[model samples]
Target: MKIKLEESTFGLLLASLLLIFGGVFSSAVQYDYTAVIDCLADPLKPQYNGGIIINPEINDGVKGWTTHGGVKIEQRSSISGNKYMVAHNRKQPYASVSHKVLLEKDKLYTFSAWIQVAGKNTTVTALFKTGDGFEKVGAVEAQVGCWSMFKGGISVASSTPAELYFESNDTSVDIWVDSVSLQPFTNEEWRSHQEQSIQKVRKSNMRLQVVDQNGRPIPNANITIQQNRLRFPLGASINQNIVRNTAYQNWFTQRFTVTTFENEMKWYTTENTQGREDYSAADSMLAFTSQHRISVRGHNIFWDDPQYQPWWVKNLSPQSLGPATDKRLNSVVSRYRGRVIAWDVNNENLHFNFYESKLGGGITNKFFQRTRQLDRRAMLFMNDYNTIEDGRDSTSSPSKYIAKLRQLQASLGANSVIGIGLEGHFHTVNIAYVRSALDTLAATRMPIWITELDVQAGPSQAAYFEQILREVHAHPGIQGIVIWGPWSQNGQCYQMCLVDPSFRNLAPGNVLDKLIHEWGGATAQATTNDNGYIDVSLFHGDYEAKFVPQGGRVDEVSPQGKSLSFAVDHNSSGQVIKFVSHV
Candidate 1:
């Protein structure tokens, strides 16, 4: 029989039905709802702790490990759980202890350890098995001194077992290690952490504007903003006419964020390019660059290229070599102590060593020590080339580079060598190899800079250049990039020029412009939305915001001025700056 049910009874009946079949109904609803939360867990995210390397803390007295060349366990209360491993090598150049660990294919693994050096420097090397042989995944050098943390990692290209070894090059020092760890992380997690590290330390920002006494928006004004202390140096080499040529100057200011005087600042150019210390050009260049707020990189205090050394010093005997080295370092570094950002103390030590032969092996240490003393603020770098090129298995391989750095650290202490400069002169690049090289160098916890990056001129030059720049920018370990090619009129540059001398963008230049303005970082432009407000996202740095009367015009001469200038900062949130146009 058909019977009418009251509203309350029907509601109760529906509630009862929902209680009984809620699970199925909920699933059906979720299937139809497009905005539902993803119920699946991310597989890339590690679900468990990575495989353990036995005796990582040396808690078991070096058990579950192969000891080679005077490896022993030390009991120290300061260390975790009061125990650590010490590899003391006094006779031979090699001493190490390694623990084998299994790693997954196509996964990123990071290996780290707490290390202390007593006499000289030591290194932690990671090796993986490949068809060819044991390929070095990465190596990290520990500075000689008190306990320091060093780390390195690799993305396993295949399913292979890896070994983490701590090696002391010689009997020069006692290497101590503890708290070793091999951990796996997803790319997303790694990049998220890196972003945290990058933004953890905030710099103060300034918000400025130029206008008349009355508040008005000045649009399309010529503006220049210079950073006081450059943590990142995105720059390019300036042409010979940088100071005089309008095109060159405009291109330098608009495109490059950092400045490297092409030939004017080099040792040969400054001291003896003309067989005399005619720094007239260099002095003028430095002044103009400084005024424009472009940080300069001391290309070289001394050039080791045998064909490029000054004639007077080339014939100098061993006795006078040290003094000549000191004079040159003192003269160049002392003059621009606070002005230039970093000094390429000895250029390409890996490629040549004229000074080493004449002044002995101590020249590098002395150069660093003297540069440190003269300009304590500027970083001292040993610049080199071919360190991260496609064919790296040859002489200037990453392993060879790591070994050289270890020797320098052993003699000069870790603080002496503050930066690693790689002249990224590329014909072709193996991106995987480049990433591996950067990972190995990052272990030292030093700033890794692409000091002279430029691709060879080719049909694919633009593509290759863009690819390299993207890779560098993607890496958190990389500090900055400085291109070493000029925008020559005839496209005959040292490498690939970014622009034509007519100030027109070439292919490479187009890619670079996109990276700088659209992808890498961005600038915001909009008229005040009734409230004289515009919002923009910027990487932490100094900025110059130009405002003018917006009517689709670049610039216009007002009774007061053509445009207004504003120096503004986005250091914190909720920042509102006012610019009263005096013009």
Candidate 2:
């Protein structure tokens, strides 16, 4: 007898059977299927060494390895018989052990390794030397005594022979490496993996059973399931134009269920004169969103960039700036306390520190504490740019972001509610690096939101936009996404616009609509089997289900048919809804 089950259940059952049979089924699986199992698993010490790198674990004493820039290289073993490669006696920062590998064009290669420094902590970057120039794969802050996992990837336009190596600016420390891996995947394979992830993360399996009022099984019953609202917050940014223009309102309301006011809620716009404040524009915008039942994310309470601050506030002394900021925070958070769902408490603190440099080093912590006091229910976020967009900006790298988060958490206590807010403004999308960065930040287990996601204007803008949206949506760590594109009277936007001046759909807008429709659970019809059960897969959201008897009309609101509502969110599991029929 053959039985159908979910992939996870099947895997567990297969593993149990293998354990009982004692190696009978082990040899049948020859190829590495670990990628299919968990695509985001640690690249270092992967289940299979399928790449071109020889003796990746240094098991064969540095075989197929050579020195770069005349650096001394050797293989060493720990007391536990674990082997690793080390580059020492380096005269140049780029001097390290290297391996030559053939890379195919248009293939995405993800590289990872366990790296450590012999001395103090320093940044180590993985590089690929191709015909064009040196392409940076990824980087990690390597420290002494412990190993850090370095991850990054590159996609080439042309097939070429490339040399892979590691570089650290501090030439005084030796770069220790182990458990290296370089995995390549085609674009099609990458998309397939994304679909697989969406199935596992964003969807759930439901089994609905039909029965009579007397609890008897009723087969051949008609069932209908329709999505009411999507729980996943996929939205776009909006300016004050949405409050006035009917076309803008209709365009936005039809597509997004969540939004962030472009500049209406910012300090410079709200309190430009410092002493006098105006929230009429913001208030009107909030009212419109509230009437439409759309959720709003508080764009920010305070901006850390000096350039973004009000002219009057920037020149004030540290003592005066402290009280003014206090007043600003209290005014904003208290007014929109329960209105907003999440707050970017300190905006762009990782890049600039206007408040920190002027008010004091501990001003950011105080701002968060004050915001929490004002709105304890809302999630606080450290919203910043380039954290995942670019790998070169170590200032807002995932590691540095986490470090800053820890500092804030340490001051706020153990149970503080803080979130990772990545402002994803991209010129060119780096798929592997984005995934790796999210994986690194997911270790904190805090809620993460792509607060300001936008791809710059280019021929590949729409394609890159779709790629980024799919990648983030497929990842389980991301909670929500808000595009940075805000529509205006003119056909202009921050970097990318979804619609033209007529409020018609552009290329990116079409992609957005396509995904929105695809992810939604449009009305589906099915019939119960012999056991009076109808099995179906549904996306995570609120849904409405209806049932009708064998000879009953589904359109009629009579005793022959019944309707019910249920939610398919992260908490939903093994859901079985039984509907009682009057027939």
Best by lDDT: 2
lDDT of 1 by residue, 281-379 (tens): 878888778788888888788777788787667777888767777777788787788988888888888888888888778788778777887887887
What is candidate 2's lDDT per residue for 1-583, written digit by digit as tens?
3323335455455444432332233322221222211122222474246266788888888898899989999998766667789999988989999999999986677776778788788888888899989887777777787667756667787999999998988999999888777887766545545555566677777788888878888888888888888888988899987877899999888778899999999999999996899999989999999999999999889988888988999889988988998899999999998999999998999999888888789989999888888898988999999878987777887767877998999888987768999989999988877877777777677899999998999999999999999989977678899998756578878898898988888898988888988787358889999989988767888888788556766666564537778889755756888877665
- What's the residue-level lDDT of 509 in candidate 2? 90
TM-score for each of the candidates? 0.60, 0.88
How much RMSD separates candidate 1 from the native structure?
A: 13.4
Name the runs in model 2 displaced over 4 angstroms.
1-50, 79-81, 212-216, 547-562, 581-583
- In Å, residue 460's CA in model 2 sits off its true spot by 1.2
| lDDT value, residue 223 of candidate 2 | 86
Scanning candidate 2 in windows of ten residues, the lowest lDDT window is: 31-40
Query: Distance from true position, residue 291, model 1, in Å?
Result: 6.7
The lDDT of model 2 is 0.80
Backbone clash count, each prediction separately: 24, 0
